[model samples]
Target chain A: MSAQGQELQRQGLERPGLQLQAQVARSDFVLDVHIAQPRGRVLAIVGPNGSGKSSLLQVVAGLVSSAQGIVVVDGDTWMNEDTFTSAEKRSVGMVFQDYLLFPHLSVQENISFGLRSRGSSRAHARATTADWLGRFGIAHLAERKPRQLSGGQSQRVALARALVTQPAVLLLDEPLAALDAQTRVSVRAEMRSHLSQFCGVTLLVTHDPIEAMVLADDICVLDQGSVVQCGTVADVTRHPATEYVAKLMGLNLVSGIATAGTVALDSGGQLVTTNSDLTGAVLATLRPSAIAVHRQPPQSSARNAWEGVIRDMEHLGDRVRLDMEARPSVVVDVTSQSVVELGLQPGQQVWLSVKATEIDVFKAHDEA
Target chain B: MTTAATRSPRRSRRSKPPWVLAIPAIIALAFLLIPLAGLLMATPWTSVGELLIDPVTQQALRLSLATSLLAAGCALILGVPLAWVLARVQFPGRPLVRALVLLPLVLPPVVGGTALLTALGRRGIVGAPLESLFGITLPFTPAAVVIAETFVALPFLVLSVEGALRAMDTRYEEAAVTLGASRMRVFWRITVPLMAPAVVAGTTLAWARALGEFGATITFAGNFPGRTQTVPLAVYTLLETNREAAIALSVVLLAVCVLVLVILREQWLRPGALRS
Candidate 1:
């Protein structure tokens, strides 16, 4: 076999991942982020708007000119205090939110741009570009400019362009955020298939919970420019440590001080939680489905109970959600039949109760 | 779309554009075009071809073409880099530097030519050394025609390209940089192509300005037949000796000017002005 064929066969035998530690200071916020994703893994970064998700991605791409950071991808140090590699030399591919396809160039030209920039001959770039255009299922769009493309097609072309370089690290900033709701579902599924086959470390930044949960194997929750929580999707959702993650997971979050099996809610209430590891300040998260409503004081053995008026009610899919005006403004999901039978109405006073074991308490972490 | 299609005609009639603004716009356009009309009226059409073939007229026409193209080339070579520096770089006195760059645009052409003399003439600051060491005197030369043309034409090119550069969506270059393109490659591949319309507009403006250059050329580079006399200088000199020849020459220049204005509106300025 030829030496080139041998070298091609030797690649992808094993792959390394990315390790990022960045301390970037922007005008509105400061990002103190540390994340590690194994090779062949898509780590999703879910954050609220202006929470420094893109800033972190920029730092990893080596685009931020002034930042204290060490970016290592596949055992190669791309940046540090004294030594820094420019974005062009770092072998990082980024997909911006708007796709940012060259409006002037056709699809093939856009994908071949990276290969051409790396000093490849035009014929070789054309061959490689043809392969990518087919892989992304945009072969029919090779001659069409960006304006002629649909939102989904533009996104696919963007992915093909970023992946054509075979970068060691991939940074995708809300890749599907610009798509309409109808297109986002199918495009996200297709993107999941493509991301699964990629061997490089991928950082996916998004504000949509469904996209994050559907695309990534692990989730990194960033809030106010810090990695507030990082864990498996199930771990972070089940025991959320911050209000932002709790909201993303649609769980009721209440912060307070914990003492002797009782946690004092910050908004003028108290809870007898089942948390054995409760300490000084803590945040208690409870699933809305865990709370039971009663017209009168219940004779059951539930630990935490409160009496409040219903502020409002919403009809969720297959269920009714009652927003009670209790301390911390708890939300409870009950059956539609139960709402009708109990005659639930706004401003109706009622007692709400939760079993002690249902509440999960964790240390409260205030944002910097 | 349907509403827009139906409403535009009615809207135009409801408030017949106020005569206050309409009258002035019409007067402004007529004021600019009346001189060309007069030139056309005076042009000796039957004798134009014969008169243009005269040796002096042919020499001036050829020199004008050669020198103007050269001046436009010089402006592009120097002005593009200067425009990039002015548009992208930030340092102290940047505002002052920009004001200085624009000073020549507002300066009188005669004054600019005189200034160029002190700076580059045979006995001038940098020109004296060339005369002593290299035996080169710049005045009354074709090179000086190009120099004077560049002086007046450069500001237009610099201003146009600088505006385009400032208005470019730099994210495209950022995307290229992330795709492993060096800064130079990004500037050439992404930045230049995106700025193509503006560059074309700027180059056309400079070329047209150079082709019609009069005061600066006559002041810096003396009229010496094929050596330095351009169409404008020849026209000015002809008016003193032969009125009919002068009118014919003016007719040629006016035709060229009309062609330039048409091309500017249809090709160079249209796309760049709309997008920018």
Candidate 2:
């Protein structure tokens, strides 16, 4: 194969990028999103509650009409002011949050629904449905009803139904939100591997940061019906554009004084961070897992150490959360085994230690 | 021993007569069934075979069956579309239109007979034009019997079907639309199937109403034997001549109605067909 062909085969997609801009007015707010993604790439939309992530995904898939703007995919204008394509006509496949498999139809028949809509004859549609079932490893479930299947199995059937028509763009809305936590992890990994091999523009909407980080090639953070930030995972983790995003990343974020190389705290303290280049008031973030708790002040080269009383204790599976009364409040995660070893309990005194390199500093914005 | 002793007071507080709620339900059942029981008890069993075999009575029963079945079919064909409109469509006077549909249901059957006559009588307003244009006279005929039955029975079908359509989720229709089916196709394939139980129930009720139509048929068609005198009219005419025969005919009507109700309850009120 030629270089371009090889690249196309490797990426599993080679088409023109999709361009979309929309302004949709709802009862409470207006959702405005502008996005562009190359073919074969997956873009994840992540946001907190009440963000218009699902609405934006629906607009791009032509399930809903926008009040303004257009969606152009692969050189074809799917929607515009004067002209619009219906959901069935647009080559966009959507996996709904609830995975609305037709209750009256069997798994095989459900998979054949979109293919039949595309004008395939019954015999041809049957062959295609069988092939998709085989591809999803659900051939044995061809005759089963959706209500009879496990959550993961039903999700796979939903995916098979969406992809049977070979749509040019795929939309998944909280696809794994219905699964149990253990199943979510394994199913999400399988979904990521399957999606990576798809030769179309894929958009996944989720509130789970882990799902977004694991599944998306690029992340778009949405808040209150607007795109707050859009970048690669590394860029977003290094610099979250909104307070919601920072909280979703589970960073112990504090905004206060930063002068020279050490930043002073609002509750009276100073700590060193990796961002020595910053010289003004800044926001600092560090993960709870990155901090270490000590019995006494250890003679380490780490720049962050403070005495604090444990305010709360929470047991989360194998780990325990220790909420300490440090400056601006400090939270640390320790293994349950270590909690037993250290005899950590609520109201106990301890020394909290964090490395300077682990602290990430950014210019503090008053609003966020 | 202490725990067992402590439980008696709590158990006493929990004890309430569970049958207290059945009192009103038992009274309602008696109110509905006592009249039918009275008719059954008064039936002259010795004369029932003779009454049923009477030539005029047999002719009226056949005509009643023919015209009521035809009327019910007509109601099904026209009423379902009207019900769909009233339930699903939006218009300025929708509530008013819905109320108008139920007018015949509440209007005295004799009043409905007069209304049908004014609309379809040979010298009546629109009927006059129809007669002049087509050389047709609709009054005092079997056709008039069918018209009167339809007039009184159509509201049952429409009301039942409209309630079903209103309760159905429109999301299924949208899903069908997204699956590339046109609106008409969706209605025929999805909406109709989902509303089948209601349609069947409404059809049976309307047919029963049409079979027993008396006032409208007597006023509109003027009680012609073998043409407009159905079973109900036949029973009324026989009351003056032979009270035992009339009582026997009432028993037949009651049996037929009870049988229909039992069949419908068994078929449509079961697990799969219980539509909201």
Candidate 3:
């Protein structure tokens, strides 16, 4: 390697890897997070609303308040104890949730904004912008203003515009969130393909489970402004450590205190589980599909039973999700045919039965 | 198509509008229009060209245009930055500062003239030092006319541009900065261009106000033909002796006011221009 390459490696930015340790105080919400990723990887942060997902991205991009952090990206120490880089100086690209394309500028100018700002001649910027337009298959929209474009076209333009800067660290905040459901699938595929070609550290913030599962190499679940679980997509889905993560994977999570013989739930209920000699706090999860719905209380082999009114019923194609207001308020998924057989309305009372073996009980805290 | 008035489905079923409201509306319309109608009636139409060609009248008209334009230029240079600061920045006593900027709008022009005299007149605070140091007396000069006009006209420009700056979505500016543009570049390229319609509206308003200025110009910058006497001040002098010439000049000023409103309606005041 050349001397410059070795210096870049020393700064930990040669391969477009990222290391960020930051703490920011925003009104009542304090965000204390440490995130790291090697180059050529995408870290998808899945979180509920108001979970500091966007703020985390903002701090590393040098857009937010005076966050204390050491942000080393692509061999540049953008921020640390002594150095602080403004958003205008740091080569960071972000696609905001709204896209925020300059409404007054044409598609070409929007894409070429970064180049023009970097002091490129108008002719060079225009040529590079046109190249990106062609690459993104949006050359036909080169002259059209943002308002003249459709939602899908605007999203494509936003993506192309971000990549035109050739940023070392790419940040996407809910990139697919603005599209209608029909456009999301096709756009997601296109976005995934484009992201795969980029040799950089990409941090994607999304609330949708499918978006995280499909696009991310690893998943980092954030709750209340802290990372609750970080692992491969399959691992986090299979053994979620938090209730929020369980809900994302379409499972009913029940938190309980495990004694010698039984597990006592916080919502005034007890359950018998197959796991032996578990103590202190534990989280037990049941697949929504595994719970059986009955009109009357059943005396079957199932070890747990609860009678509750249906709080909400969401029709999910062939299945219906019953948000039942039982002792612990569990989500039960039943087939649409069974929903009709049981004549389930939101106010109708029903019995829920779950076998002991079906519940997966794990220690609630990773430290514990 | 949606904005073109659809026939009111409910109007046909309702009774006629009350005479109580109708009478006052007619009175209000006539009250404002009758003076204009009388002015048109009084204009000496026959030798109007010869009257306009008269050297004194021409000079006052030229002086009026010159002073107002210069005042508008000064106001533009100063008011734009003030408006930007007022709209975009947070500071202590902002409300008080804004109120002080708008004081001239509510103060009678004569009172504003008196205030200007105490501040800029030869015997006054800054005026004494200026006169002693530079040997330059500002009163009874064209520069004084512009000073008076700018003093009274700045509020209009500042208010309009500030409202425009506040209404614009600041996200575009943030995006520009994120794209590596400096704050100055973003302001020039993004903020100023977005403020175009409002700035034009404000400039026209200030120009009209300056051209019609009588009290302040006459008091601070004494009325002198071909110098400080604008059209309104010239008309005031003519009212004492030459009624016909005064009427002609009044007609001229009225025509310019109408012309300005017509041009304003076509450009900045149009519904379409304000939408963006």
The C-alpha TM-scores of every prediction are: 0.77, 0.74, 0.76
Which whole-number lDDT from 0 to 100 does residue A360 have in model 2?
71
Order of candidate numbers by lDDT, starting with the best: 1, 3, 2
When summed lDDT is taken over every stretch of 10 residues in candidate 1 chain A, the lowest stretch is A5-14
A11-126: candidate 1 lDDT, tens digit per residue: 32233687777787867878888776788889999988888889888888888878876677776767765668888888878899998999889999999999998888999999
Model 3, runs deviating above 4 Å:
A1-16, A251-368, B1-23, B262-276
**Model 3 captures what fraction of native contacts?**
0.57
**Candidate order by TM-score, highest to lowest?**
1, 3, 2
Give lDDT tens digits, candidate 2, residues B108-214: 99988988898889879978998999988888899999999998999989987887788777665655555555556666767887788789888998999999998
Model 1 bad stretches (over 4 Å): A1-15, A119-121, A251-368, B1-15, B266-268, B271-276
Residues A207-274, model 3: lDDT tens digits:
98777766778889987767889887756764567556656867655668988636899887877888
Candidate 2, residues A1-368, lDDT tens digits: the string is 34632333333323486777778776788888878788898999888767778877778767676466667788777776666887667787778777877766789987887777668999999999999898788899999988899998989888888777777888898999999986775577578767887888998999987677677878898877788889876456545565456556554656578887789876677788867666666657678788888888867888898889998776655667677787757677788887988889989988888999998765542211
Taking chain B only, the TM-score of every model is 0.90, 0.85, 0.91
Each candidate's interface RMSD: 0.8, 2.6, 1.1
Q: Is candidate 1 or candidate 2 better by DockQ?
A: 1
Superposed by TM-score, candidate 3 places the C-alpha of residue B46 at a distance from the truth, in angstroms, of: 4.5
Q: Give fnat for candidates 1, 2 and onward, in order.
A: 0.79, 0.23, 0.57
lDDT of 3 by residue, B49-71 (tens): 88888888999989999999999
